[model samples]
Every structure is written in C-alpha cells, then in structure tokens.
Target: MTTEAKICQGPHTGGQGPSSLDELVARVAACGARPRIALAACAEAHALGALLDAMERGIAQPLLVGDMDQTARIAAELGRDISGIAAVHAPDPREAVQCAVDMVRRGEADVLMKGLVNTDVLLRRVLNRATGLPPKGVLSHVAVFELPASGGTTRLAMMTDAAVNIRPNLQRKLEIVHNAVAVARALGIARPRVAMLAATEKVILPAMPATLDAQIVARMAEQGEFGEADVAGPMALDIALSPDAAARKGVDHPVAGCADILVAPDIESGNILYKSLTILARADMASTMAGSSAPLVVTSRGDSERSKFCSIALAGYLALAARS
Candidate 1:
C-alpha cells in the first residue's frame, strides 16, 4: 500500500502529521522531482530567498517573472548566484503576475508563486476565469502546520480559508473542506481528521449559524462526501484541539485532540487562528492556495524564510501528486 493508503488504514491511529519541515522536504525528495515554479514580481528578498533555498535543495525549479536586472541585483545582495535561474522581465509587477500566470497556463510551470506583487493583483489573475489558475474546487488557503509530538508522533494540523474565503456559507465551507482534504491527501494523510470549528459545541439553531452549518457538514462527511476522512464539527477551538479540554467539557470525538484539518468558522476566525499560531505560539507554517489545477504559494511579509520555503515544498508535493 502507498503511504496515503497506509495512513488511512494503518492500525496506528495516534495522529501523525510531519514532525518537522524536514519531513516535508524529505517527502518532496522522495518524489525525485524539481517542480517548475513561476514566481511573480520576484523582487522581494523573502520570496527570492525562499526560491533560492528551494532551488538549492532541488525541490523547485523557479522561473522568475520581474525586472531581470533588479532581480539579479537583489540576488547578489542576498549573497546568492542566480546565473542559471530562468527569468523574464514583465517591466511591471502586475504584468509580472500576468507573465507568471501565463507560464502556468502554458504548462511551462507546474506551480505559480507570488513574490513582491500585491496579493490583490496576484489574486486577480488567479481568480480570472479566462487566464487565472484553475482550482479543483473553490480557491481556498490551506495552511499546514507541524505540531510538536504529543506521544511520539508529530501531528500535522491544517487550517483552511484563513486568507482566502471571507464569510463562507455551507456550500462554500463544503468546498473549502474538499480543498483542504485534497491538500491533506497530498501530504500523505489519507483519511485526515477534520474538525469543523465553531464558537462552542452546541448545535443551537438560528443562534449559532456556524454550529448549525458545521453539524450539517459533519453529517455530509458521514455520508462519505470527504472520502475516508473522519469529520466532526460544532466544536470550539479548544474542544477540537485539546483532549484535556474535550474531556473537561465531556466531549469525546475521534477528531478531538487529533484533528488533521480545522475548518474555521469564517475568515475572521481563521485568520485569527492562523496568526495566533504563527505570531504567538511560535509555530512553523506552510501556506498555499489550493483548489486550483496548480498550487500557488502565498505567504505574509512577516513570514519567515522557513515558512516561505515550506510553502514552496507544499506546492511541490501537491504538484507532484497531480502529475502522478
């Protein structure tokens, strides 16, 4: 059986994600691939650094779209050599996004990454039905996290639509879950445990829209909508993550204390959860835009190079999966 199949069927259900970014990188290496990535507006240090690292590690082959001269200068400043890195000059940031997006559409690139360009501009191309990257479902942000081992197993946690979907309704949430589950499957989690996050565990009608929606979504999962994944919902953040909290609250769920995916209530709560983990909890995260035919690496300015590289690795793994 493949790793994913084993994950879904393996007797050990002690919840394991990757222990470190090293594991993700190792998975990419196992694919024996260097995914071609078209990075738009490649003028920022963070983005370029990430690309350089990925290239060095042989995880990605980058096609830089930006001012070639400026990108070369920045590379020199960063103490890196881009003598062999393929690049194109778009003369402007927006046009650079166009160039990168066009590369993906042309099959010259397996992945599209955002560099120095504004997110709105990059997204305009990504969401453009005529020219944008096509997602498998709805475009949603899937941020992967490698949590510390809680019992000799490193748990991988994923949060969805943290930076993309705004106020996702029931249908949109379903799409978001599918999108995230696709990502989880890419990461070798066959039957990922999904927890639909809400304010509380109560399924009060009309009073808690999120809870009600989550309840229905869990039922849909029970109906085998999300493959072999275990889906639970109408639970608070703490109840979803902390077994101790779940027990204190008398909540016993297979997904509780071991959720692979956390379906946020909305973008507000999703963003807050994502930021809290990164900024305060000192978590390492890899975020990418999924639901497309191609994976898009998206990161924050405040993100570390490791995070950005993780995003690249995430995209690489997904791209490899699609090809396979």
Candidate 2:
C-alpha cells in the first residue's frame, strides 16, 4: 500500500471528522474493541481517575503497572473500584515504566500512558535504542484542540511538536509535518488543511530562517510530498485561523483561513500556544506522541482529569484505526 493509504486507513463516518473530543471518545467506544492501555507508575490519582473513566466508557482496558498498594489507595480515595482491572507489581517508578513499555513491545498493550512518573524518565525508556519502541519516523507531539468557531460551532484543530523536537530544521520540520498529517488522517480528516506557522508570511532568508523553511515545505506540499493534504506556509498566527485576518492580509491560499492543523516553527512558540489555549482560552484538548510503534499518552501532570481521559480516547482511537 502507498504511504498515504496506510496513514488514512481507519474507521470514519461519512467522510466527516469529529468536531469535539466527546465525539472522538464516542467513536472509539463504538469501534467495539478496547485498546489495552498500560499506565506506567499508575499510582497518581488524576491519572487513575482518567483511566477509570476511559474504562467505564469502554474506550480502554487498563493494565496498571505500578505500586499496587498505592494504586489501590488512590482508587479508594477517588471512590473508584479497580478490583476487576489487571495490574503488575513494580514498586520502582522506572521499573514500572520499563515493564509497561515491555508490555507494549510484547503486544500485550496497545497504548502507553504516563502516570506518576516524570516525563523524562518515561521518555528515556521509550526512546532507548535497544529495548525502546521503534519509531516509524521521528517522534513528534500532536495536540488536538476543539476551539470555538464563528458560527457558534466548534472545530477540531491540531498543533505539533509542542512537547518534543526542540528546534527542528527544514528536514526535521518535514518529518514533523508527516507525523502530524498521519494523525490528522487517523482522526478522519480526508484532506487536512495544514498551516505552517512562522512569525511572518514573507521569507527574508537568513534574517528569519523559519519563514524560509516554511516556504520550502509549502512548495514540497504542492509537489504532493504530504499526500492529499493542503499545506501553506509562512503564515502568521492570525491568518492561519481567522478568515477576516487572512482577508485583511490578502493571503490567498486553500489553508489560509480554515486550517485544520497549525505547524509551529519551534518548540517555544508551540508550547506557548498550547498552554495559552488550555489555560487562557479554556479550549478542550487532547495530545499524543506520533511516530511510535504504538500510541503514547504523555499529558502534563498538571493537566486535568478530563484532559487525560480525552488523551486516552485519542490514543485509543488511533490504535484501533491502525488495527483496522
């Protein structure tokens, strides 16, 4: 099969993508097969609560890999019953992460989730050369957001590499786009409109490298490098999402105003946008790491239980899509 065909293969309804996180969860539940999620260091209350919620919704089957005593304690504190759930005892946090990663490698789990463990610790094991999960390409983070639109409706949008890929160059940025495109396709977007974000739309060479890279990437997209997606580059933030802003700036492109994905120039800008939306705009969001052998849920420890649950659903949906 072609790369595009592989990326776009999945269960979707009537060629329409989900407009909200709840709809995404519903679709995952409707898939009829629960993806097994291995929660590393599963002793944290919020993470456990989220996993329990996913289990109740029939979106995921949890395999707790942590301190069983602590897990039980957290479950009790949250008034949740984990008696029917399966768990492996690994008191050490790193050991728990390793065990969970091993389960994913062994096909016993379809997703790997971070719990009480630190992000760096969990990632070290996941990116380990010999025992780690083999990446399809370079691993990049994709954050999915459901934002309020002009017509009192909401639309799902995505931003990439906010939590990974510190300073992606032209080549690495291409890989990031590929990873984000795969995610958008898995989420039922038939032809994702991708906006390559930079400080400005004008390319001024060495003065602003991001704009040059964005222009080149956009040209590559025009050459069918990113499959059926519409990629336009060097777009200012305002022009990417606001039709009025695009019109005011006279930016004419298919992805100018109604972009489904925003490709940030670097980690700083991407991370800033991510936190701002979550905290200030109060946007509903879900995030996952793409290019891994299996889906990975690595939401911030400060993220709400709802966010964690949605992240699980997002990852679960991707896992099911890969299987189908």
Candidate 3:
C-alpha cells in the first residue's frame, strides 16, 4: 500500500473542532512509528510533563539527558514514572545538549527535544560544526496549529529566523520560505498559498527593502523558480489574516484572502506576532525546527501543556513521513 493510503487508514479524528493534542499524538503513533526521542536538560517541570505524556501514550521512547538527580526530583514532583526511561547523567545544560546531539548523531534517537537549557546553548551545540546531528546550516522555526475556527484541518504559519536567523537578507528569506514550504508539503498541503507579510500592501517608495523583496519573490514563484507554492507578499498583517481587511484595501490576491502560510519579513516581527497570537489571542501552537536532517522540538517553557504535546506529535508525524 502507498504511504498516503496507510496514513488515511486511520480514523478521521483531526481537522475537526477543538482537536486534542493527545489525539494528534495518538494518530502519529498509529502511523507505524514509535520514534526514539532524546531530551536535553530534562529537569524542567513542563518539559518533563510533555515527555511523560508522550511516554505514557506510547508515542516516544525518551532517552533523557540531564542532571539525573534533578531529573528524578522533577519527575517525582510531577508524579511521572521514570522507571523504564533511559536517563543519561549530564549535570549541566550545555553538556545535556551535547548528549542529545550525540544521541541523534549516533543513530540512537530519531528526534531531539529541548528542556531547561538556554536557547543559545542548545543551538550552539546543535549548530556546532563538528558534532551536530545535521550539518551546520540555516535553521528556522515553523509553528503549526489546528485552530477551531478553521475546523480540524491543520494550518501552518512560519516566522523566518524567529528563533535562529537574526537578520536574514533576501537569499536567507528564500531559504526560510523554502523550509516552510517543505513543512507545508509534509502536512499534505498541495500548492500552499504563502503570504509574505510587510508593513503595508504596496511596495512603497524607499520605505522598506522587504516589500521590494516580497514582490521579487512572488514573481520568482510565478516564473517557476520556487516550487510547489503560490507566493505573494509585502502584505500587511491585517490583510494577511483577515479577508475583510484585504477587501477594504482592494487587494486582489489569492494569498491575501486565504493564505496557508504567513511569512514574516524578519525575526523580531515574527517573534512578536507569534507571542501576541499565543499570549493575547489564546492560539494553540506546535513548533519545530526545520531545514535539518530531522525534526527538532524546542518548545518554550512559557508554552501551554497542549502546545508542548502538540509539538511532540508534529515531530513524530514528520519523522514517520520521512521514513515513508
């Protein structure tokens, strides 16, 4: 049987209203994979909770690396059973990050999960030239969501270099968009509509280079330079997310009304927009590192329990699909 046929054999439980993160994880587990996951700095309470949930549901076999004593204490506080988990003793966050990277590099784990480490510390090891799991290259974060308003079908939005690339130029932006489009394809989105967000709809004179770059990239897509996506950009945030805003501004573009991927011009805008959506709008999120040899889940400590679990589910599904 084909991979899509296998994936479709599962019950249609997603893309409905108020989809559960656990249910997403369960469906991924049903896809004939129980990925071995490596957790770095596994002493944080929330991270431990997510790992515990994944373990209990048989979605992942976690090889946890951190301060063993601290891990035990945190696990006890969370009432998590670590009886069968493999705990590697790395007392510091940097060391734990190295251990996690080495696990994946050695073919012992399929995915990497971050815990209580500093983001830079974890990234330094992962992007280290000599010992990283994947080669040191462009790493971007794309957070996916299954919003109730959109029904059960999953929606993907990406903020380039949000957690990695600080100030990307036009070339880096192309790489970022390509990474996000790969994620869209992995989620079964055919010809995903991409909106390159700008401060305004029009490419104003001498205001921002991003708007000009957006127009250029959209034309690139039209010319078949970029593959498998309809890319339009230099759109305002309001128009990108709201059809009414687009209609009022007389923006006649397919992505303006119904964009599947919203691409921010830079890291600050993307980070601010993502945090605002989560903190203010109560949007659920599942984030992973893209443009790597494997899917990486580095969920924030401030994330909701549901978000953490959903990220694990997303990583699991990507790992399964890679094998498929």
Q: What is the lDDT for 212 in model 3?
A: 90
Q: What is the C-alpha RMSD of each candidate to the true structure, in Å?
A: 4.3, 3.5, 3.7
Error of 2 at 151 (Å): 3.8
Model 1 per-residue lDDT tens digits across residues 1-324: 133323222111233434566787776765555788998999888899998899888788889999888888999999999988898987699899998999998888988998888888898888888888866568898999877667776667899878889999899999999999887876767788999999888898887899999999999999999879899989888887888898898888899977889999899999999989898998889998878878899877888878999899888777766765
Model 3 earns a TM-score of: 0.88
Residue by residue across 240-294, what tens digits does model 3's lDDT show?
7778888998988888767767888888988887888788878877888897777
> How displaced is residue 71 in candidate 1, in Å?
1.0
Q: Sort by TM-score, best first.
A: 2, 1, 3
Task: Kindly indicate the candidate among 1 and 3 with the higher lDDT.
Answer: 1
Pairs that clash in candidate 2: none
Instruction: Please give each candidate's TM-score.
Output: 0.91, 0.93, 0.88
Model 3 lDDT-worst window of ten: 9-18
lDDT of 2 at 164: 89
Q: Quick one: how many clashes does candidate 1 have?
A: 6
The local distance difference test score of model 2 is 0.88
Which lDDT values do the candidates have, in the order given?
0.83, 0.88, 0.76
Off by over 4 Å in 1: 1-19
